[model samples]
Target: MVFFKYPEQIRRVMYTTNTIEAIHRQFHKLTKTKVRFSKQNNLLKLLYVGIKNASTKWTMPFPNWNLAVSQLAICFEELLDATLDL
Candidate 1:
């Protein structure tokens, strides 16, 4: 049960639901600011658009793909390649 994150911008990844809650805060903001929409569908549209925009600027995967895959194969060899058919 270990996790690692890059040192670029976001530091340690906490167990708490902080990131999701932060996004939910944006939804709350939309409901408050954009009052009196003609119908419920418009509210849904606003929330969906806001989340889509936020996700676009998210940080990318860790750059060293090969190294990570190799380490994982070694660590979980029993489950990944457990049999020898050939």
Candidate 2:
């Protein structure tokens, strides 16, 4: 499979979709507790606060991030260069 062609470190990063799901779960929990919002802005504010709080918990670096970056750099050198030029 194409996924297995990459190093293990890169594969781990690719499969770790739980982080996004966790954020959604947290947002759901925050919004679920409050059934009513007086305004749309209030709901937005609650989600903003939830995001801020969730960001704090993400302070740790991803495991083997350096290795993953190196692998990605090698795999997508041309794409990376194009992005960097923009």
Best by lDDT: 2
What 10-residue stretch in candidate 1 is worst by lDDT?
8-17
Number of backbone-clashing residue pairs for each candidate, in the order shown: 0, 0
* CA error at residue 75 for candidate 1, angstroms: 13
Prediction 1 global C-alpha lDDT:
0.61
Over 16-79, each residue of candidate 1 has an lDDT whose tens digit, in order, gives 3267887888788778766589998988898899899767856565555456445555655676
Off by over 4 Å in 1: 1-11, 15-17, 60-86
lDDT of 2 at 9: 74
TM-score of 2: 0.76
TM for every model, in the order presented, reads 0.47, 0.76
